[model samples]
Target: MSRRPITEYAVLSDCRSAALVSSDGSVDWLCFPHFDSPAIFGRLLGDEAGYWSIRPDGETSRTRRYAGPTMVLETTYRTRNGMVTVTDGLIMGAGNRGHDLGAGAPGALVRRIHCTEGAVRVAVIFAPRPEYGLIEPVLREVPGGLLIRGGA
Candidate 1:
């Protein structure tokens, strides 16, 4: 299948694994628990089939960058009326910094967003896709968050 060229995306991880946050504010690609483990989010392959995303209420222009040499991503969205900025990154352990991707204890992907300029409405959607397109797994909302079952 053909894939849409991602206009922009950012990488965030807690050392064990990484997730890609799209310019639209969606976490399109992510591998949970371990980097080589089954992907918990895979919407990057199809429409609304995998992962999570965040975007403005409507169409808008966006710009993104890494915060210094860190894995923290700073994305700015510009609309007809105002602009907003989103900061996304994985919370690392003490004394750890940069895009090491392999220097922290297991942790969840942390996405922190802030409005830098003006007021802009944002939309958030979370849909996890596991096992690519082969298996249709079951979704369960656990205590902490959602979990997927099945897939070998």
Candidate 2:
């Protein structure tokens, strides 16, 4: 895929860290743990860097907007078969403080998808190269999702 204009990306944040997700449903930039940390997904700089994408199986017309005044993002895709909405955000803890300050905060990236009409096939790919493509992390399938670990 060709590089998209930077203006085409949407911001998702939790007051501690942020992610830049493109209109096509690809998270091109993400700094984890803290705002100053290195990016795990840096495809915005190079193709080999890394990326996480969840999108429809084929072409789709898309419209996106921040869910409200917050950093939560809602992107709706209309495919030939059906329509789906994907909500992305860096999880926030209670009291609305930085995620790290909350007792239950896990510093997690959340992506919620819902199918509103018809039926559509979705695909998800997560390829993380931590420390800005310096270290390729190991991914192990867990009970719920894959666990990523590497680097220091």
Q: Pick the candidate with the highest lDDT.
A: 2
Clashing pairs in 1: 25-54, 26-53, 26-54, 27-52, 43-50
lDDT score for candidate 1 against the true structure: 0.72
Give all candidates' CA lDDT scores.
0.72, 0.86
Worst 10 residues of 2 by lDDT: 95-104
Give the per-residue lDDT digits (tens) of candidate 1, residues 48-81. Answer: 4576677778889988888888888888889886
Best by TM-score: 2
Which pairs in model 2 have colliding backbones?
none
lDDT of 2 by residue, 36-85 (tens): 98899989989778999999998999999888688889999999999999
Models 1 onward score TM values of: 0.72, 0.87
User: What CA root-mean-square deviation does each model show from the true structure?
Assistant: 3.9, 2.6
